[model samples]
Target: MYDYDQVTAFLGKWGPFQRLIFFLLSASIIPNGFNGLSAVFLAGTPEHRCRVPASANLSSEWLNNSIPLEERDGRQVLSRCRRYRLEALAHFSATNLEPGRDVNLSQVEQEKCLDGWEYSREPYLSTIVSEWDLVCDNDWKSPLTTSLFFVGVLFGSFISGQLSDKFGRKNVLFLTMGIQTGFGFLQIFSTSWEMFSILFLIVGMGQISNYVAAFVLGTEILGKSIRIVYCTLGVCIFYAFGYMLLPLCAYFIREWRMLLLALTVPGLLYIPLWWFIPESPRWLLAQGRVQEAEDIIRKAAEKNHVTAPDVIFDPIKVQDLNSQEQQTYSILDLVRTRNIRSITIMCVILWMVISIGYFGLSLDTPNLHGNVYINCFLSAVIEVPAYTISWLLLQYLPRRYSMAAVLFLGGCVLLFIQLVPTYLSVVSITLMMIGKFGITSSFSMVYVYTAELYPTVVRNMGVGASSMASRFGSILSPYFVYLGAYDRFLPYILMGSLTVLTGILTLFLPESYGAPLPDTIEQMLRVKGIKYRSASKSQRRLKYGEENSVILKNTSL
Candidate 1:
């Protein structure tokens, strides 16, 4: 078994570079956060000031004359007054009067004393309605765009995975980062909603590549024992930065466009990734590029000032390489095996439920309180504790139990919000926020868990499919809000039930705690019964050299 000390040493030596990769990866996806929340600023009612004609009489007689006496109470008084005022004023023709001539008394007075009601309303309502031509215009189009973007992400993931497999993870990362940065900036300059949606899709496509490449590279570079910890921690810190930066962006740039521009600016900084990040040696060897792999190994050895030994990189001979196959896996391969199919179904369902509930709740931040900024900040603030707890729980609890408990707790909290009275809605929202934290934490855990379940060759594909499914949930979430589900917390009820069910379902998956990463489906199936092949005695001695000399000396003695 791999020891924690060895993993820590490896991370200590290479952790900075690993952190850098994750940072860039996280920055590239910040636009997702923007897209996720931009509706609050973009689609809300705008404040407008309009004046009513002054000559119009809004007195008791007008109300009494226009409306039946029985209907002339407080509720109908305003409507009756407006109707009579408009009717009485219609006979006068002010436009026909000569220039400088005295206008009619009704026209002059009505113009002077404006009494009409004016309130803020959504500005782009007509345009949005005409564009989609839907019954309601509750920003469903934005999530539609989001959904398309995720579809693009599915394609991008596959393409980027192939490119990373063929060329290298680092180069793909740099290229994808550059593309994401460019398109993300272009989103700021988008003139129309269509243009913005299109650009968002493009940005999402490229963003997926950055995430897939960085994750694969990080996992490949790390030692086996701590891979899950590093991957999870990397994402946790990324979200921590996201929560910190998103609020700052919201504060500095009140306009949604300006905020998006600010988010895009950081992506440009990742361009230097071309020079700093290195290709994964494991990938090179998997592709039969032994010379290239050895060269990379030599550079890493040089950087650490460790000597390299000559060895033939044969897949069949090396225990680590034994599972390497030349064939590339496709989406269909995910469902080809019963076990992979089960994992895929479970992951997809979990992803969909988490995303729908998590994002639906987060997006309701504007409706939760008067001060959207404060509410959004508070919501993000809660995530910090959730992540901290997740880190601790993941270390101690079985993966299934941890995932289940969080999901169930989150669901219960969401359900509890519904029974509370409107006066206590804030308390309910706070509970919902805590639930959001739990769901978000569970969402992050799914990534690590899924990665652990799938082999290296098909890992990205499996994750990519889950990403696509989650986006589908995002697409459907807007409709939940559109249907006034958020108004009475019905969405929360549905999401909560689904989450609890997902938690129960998680109990069935085989525990991967302390297990070696299975490099093939066959290996994954035989995890308990079949012992993993180990490196030969001579090979181990040759690889370790003087570092293991003490152990060898002790054994000999």
Candidate 2:
């Protein structure tokens, strides 16, 4: 097994730099929050109106004759009749004015007369049938475009994760950022529905890589003590920050395309990631490139004004043997083990439930009765407190209990939304938003918990696969929104039941609060709670020697 003390000592020596990198990687995900609002801009069709100029010779008799006296009262009625007659004359003159002909109007003068009356009305001309109409244009085009973007993300995660492992995290980060920036800029110039769909897909492809790299790189560089917090809560904070920024964009940028362009601008700043971000040393060692890993470590030590230790690199010492011994982790491996199998099954069900209900609720937000802007704003605002609740509960309660409570509460809230009368729709939405907050928190917790359950080698692969599965829920969300044809509550009923079922599954998962992170399949399979099953007598002695060496090294430093 790898020496935890040595790793801890190394982390303590270099923790500050890791923390800084974590913050930057977290900041990188902020732009994705605005994606929820992208449809609003893509479908906007604002109307413009111009009025005709007033004419002095307009007849009042015709307009007065048009108005019925029973609908009129005294001077107020007479004044309205006279004003209407003059406005009618202006409308006629503006439409029919002859330039340089019988009329004395020049082309310029005629145009001015057309602009003469007051500006009348300017309204958005787009169709508004359901709540989805206000949220996004309910055309086949916008939904298809949005779905294509998620599809890109599904593929991009797998591609990016592998590339990061092969090349290095920093390079992938820089490359993905550059690609995302380019695609984001292209999305602004998309004129037709087809063009926008294609651009968004490209954008999603670029964007997915960055997030996967950021999460992996952040966790790899940090100490185990703070790894979960830095990766999970840290990532969640950035996501929430992105959510908060969406409303600000809505308020400032009225034009949809302009708003998208504005959102894309910040991503360009991430280009400098090439120079600042470094490759993960742990990853290098795992690939048996010890010299390169040592060099990187030496450079980091130099930057921190600390001298490099005189030590020989050993592949056997560095490799996470527990992970290597497993060789292959199949679906059967997940279930064949007792505690592990139960955990895997629970995780899968929870992933499905949270994915469906969380996204289902979010997708339906536009249909909720209220100003779309205010409703979105409130929903985002509530997430801050939701995060706080997550932080608090995670510290006090066992992971499963906290997850179950939150999910059950979320389900109850969804049921409440369905049962509430239409007149009390606002109250129902408010409760639904609270439920959404709980579910989102639960979703974040699951990501953290999954990392702790498995050993290191399969960590990225397992998380990536599970995340991709959860994304299926996101993929189905737009279709559910479109399914308002049958009944608006149909999606809600399905999503709510799934969440409750997930909560029940949470009971099956074992508590992992103080358990050592399983390094190998043998350690994972120790159902009798036996200790050190994988290590031989000689290996145990070597482990003690390494622990002593790590203690001596730390003290000398």
Candidate 3:
């Protein structure tokens, strides 16, 4: 049977139809750039201390002393979670002698904040922490909120592939887009943290789901040559566009609710894209809807002002499409062979560590000493070059070496951050941004490299498991950022160490650049780079009707 690409060769690779799909689908990814990182501003913890009550009956001088001083990062500052017992201080004021010199000020009792906190309005006028009072004993809740969203991302990553496969990519793409846009809008009116968290989870589910759909849709529709560019520069650069826009929006919109609102409204304009972007013909043909697939190609040919073959799909019998259905493989198949198992495990570790550095560094921006807005914007802006460099590395360098190099670079830079003086914030911020750049570049490389590492039969499932692992990394990342509260260098030290470890692990995996991708586990054994381990029972191939029973799972799930 003729392949789908051969049948549709008349439409050409870079025609008007492909360009439209490329831009519109890439355009859809813009919202994810900001939405994914919105928590940096939305959940920001501003400088705050215990609020003093007017009834304390203290003058301005005594009022300034209401808050007890505590040591933080080796500096004396007003305590955030505790204060001098205001009534005790009021009573002490009655004595003629000053408390510190005449009486022992240490004798004054310190207590947990009974009154609310007073947060500095700079940077963010209102954040979720300020609005909901998620500080002191409740301070842990702030990072938990970010973790819950990633929990939603985990669920979404696991299921979106299955949903997209069963229902078709276009359907899942638009459906998730609706879920993301609708839930994001609803979050604006949340009266309590519970309500907001529930909605944000749904938004997270939608956010990654739509991104997966658009990514799959574009890659499937465009020709093999353009797919690389779309994946590297096209998709990544546009996402950077949205990321660069995030700080700009946050800078202008000081309120958390308004920042969310600004980030979500752009999704509405993408509604019209449903009409413009056609269902992928490759997906249609796989579904055994030959005529629908041909019709789409016909329309694409018209858009490109070219002629398609009169019977482009006739060579592909409807029955041949069922072959993909017969070759079902599950996640277990990943470890069924030595070469594939090693690849899968390595990919998972690399993906998880990349996510740890990616999100950990991103969320830690607010804690960086320089201007938070500039720090975040520069973080986003650096991705353009990182992605471009990743594309170059993909074209010119060995996949394993490139992946390891970026990981090592990012890890080393982060590891060095602890050595910089805290007062040299410019130096510290520069190191952090450099770490972000290396990780960001590694992030793109892993996506492409993982796709190349797996055989076509179990590619999507392999990537899905890896992506699920990534959510674990993301969920833990906020806590890594939370480590800043305990010691500023802890998050960097941990993420950097893990990243460097993964880089060393990448060296053991077979390189994929300039090599034919394995189509089956049998095919992988013959590939040049894989150094086979001692064969075991699991690696033995079954030689019976049971082999035929293993159905091939769909790709890019």
Candidate 4:
């Protein structure tokens, strides 16, 4: 049977048709970047204090002084969750008050704020925190919202692949895009935190579903040479650029509702793209819609100014199509075989580490040592170079080596952060960015490596399972950030340790570089040579050393 890549070579390779699809699909990812991390700014808690009532008739000095000081981490600070019982204090004055002689200030009764809280308006004019008093006792709600979003992503990852395969990639792509855009807009009018969180969950499902559909579609439609570029530079880079735009958007649009609205409005730009992009030809062929697939191939050839054959997939025998349709697979298949089970487990762990480290650092931007806007922008910007470098390494190194190297390096940088002096914040932040760059590069490599590891029958299932693990890790990321209250370096310490462990585990997976994608459980476990289908003797492959020896032998002759 002819592989999709071989058939695609005739249609076009890195041509105008392919370029348009790549850009349009990648562009749709920008809104996802914004909505995914919007929680950082939208739910950020500003410096706040318990609200004091004016009915107490206390002087300006007395009113400001009413909130008593408490010792925390060796520093005196005003109480945020509690205030003095003002009825008795209203009668007292500076003349009558003395720390020890007249009244012991520490003996004053304190109670939780009866009237709401006052928030600082410096970084944000409005946020979920200020709008609903989600501070102090309610602070837990902020992280919970972010976690709920990823819960939706977990469900979406499990379902989107099956839906895209049953229907068509293009239809699923558009449907998810609509879901993302519609729910995002709905969030602006939310009457309560519960309503906003529910909408955000639906939007989260749409976001991941949209991204997965685009990724699978691009991989199927583009030529082999261009597929890696599409995944890394085209998809990941565009997503990173959108992430960079987020903080800048938030910096100007200080109101949380308007900021969210601004991020969502970009989804409208993708609507016109529906006319320009076509369904994946490979998927069409799989569904036995040969005419529709052929038409798309011909259109691609015409746009690329190349002459295409009368029937691009003419070599596919009837038996081959039947074989594909007859073959059945399930989640059980992933673990039913020893080799596949090992591969699936390792990929899951690696993906989980990447998610926690990547998002743990990303969502913890406010805690970093710099202006939050600049820190976030820099964090997003760093991924661009990391992804580019990943593409370059993919061309030169084995998949396992490149992935493990980056993961290990990222972990080291994260761990080393603990040694940096607190006053030398610039050094610390730079190291954090470097650590991010490493993990980001590994993230790009993992997607490509995962696809190549699994056989065609279970490829979608394998990637989807790995993605679900990633979403699970992302769900845990907010809690990781929340740990900073005990100690600022705690999140980094935990993320770093796990990343290092995953990096080591990544080394155990068989190298996919210069190797065939196994089509059966037997082939996956036993076959270690060749770069194509190994079911036939003609497809037998020579090792790298053997190929080198062959060249030397020919030269000597």
* Highest-lDDT candidate: 3
Candidate 2 CA-lDDT value = 0.64
Candidate 4 lDDT over 450-534, as tens digits, reads: 9889888898789878988899999999999988866889899999999999888887788889888878766663223324433
- For each candidate, what TM-score against the reference? 0.70, 0.72, 0.93, 0.89
Candidate 1 lDDT: 0.64
| Stretches of candidate 4 exceeding 4 Å from the true structure | 71-74, 98-102, 312-325, 337-339, 455-457, 525-557
**How many times do residue backbones clash in model 1?**
5
- lDDT per residue as tens, model 1, 429-458: 788788888897897778777777887878
Models sorted by TM-score, best on top: 3, 4, 2, 1
Model 3, span 1-557: residue lDDT tens? 55666667788889888999999999989998998889999999999999988888876766777787888987999999998888788876766446667657677888888989899999889999999999999999999999999998988987887888889999999999989989999999999998999998999999899989999999889998898999898888989999899999999999999888998888899888889988877777777887898888889999999987778776347556556455789889999977777878777888888998999998888998868899999999999999999999999999889988998999999999999987888988888888999999999988888888888889878888888888999998999999899998999999999999999988887778888988987776333456657556655555333554544322323
For candidate 2, list the clashing residue pairs, or say none.
Answer: 41-256, 322-520
> Which ranges of candidate 1 are over 4 A from the true structure?
1-139, 287-299, 302-343, 451-464, 514-557
TM-score-best of 2 and 4: 4
Superposed on all Cα atoms, the candidates' RMSDs to the truth, in angstroms, are 11.6, 12.9, 5.5, 7.3
lDDT at 344 for candidate 1?
85
Q: Could you tell me the TM-score of candidate 2?
A: 0.72
> In terms of TM-score, how similar is model 1 to the real structure?
0.70
By summed lDDT, which 10 consecutive residues of candidate 2 come out lowest? 73-82
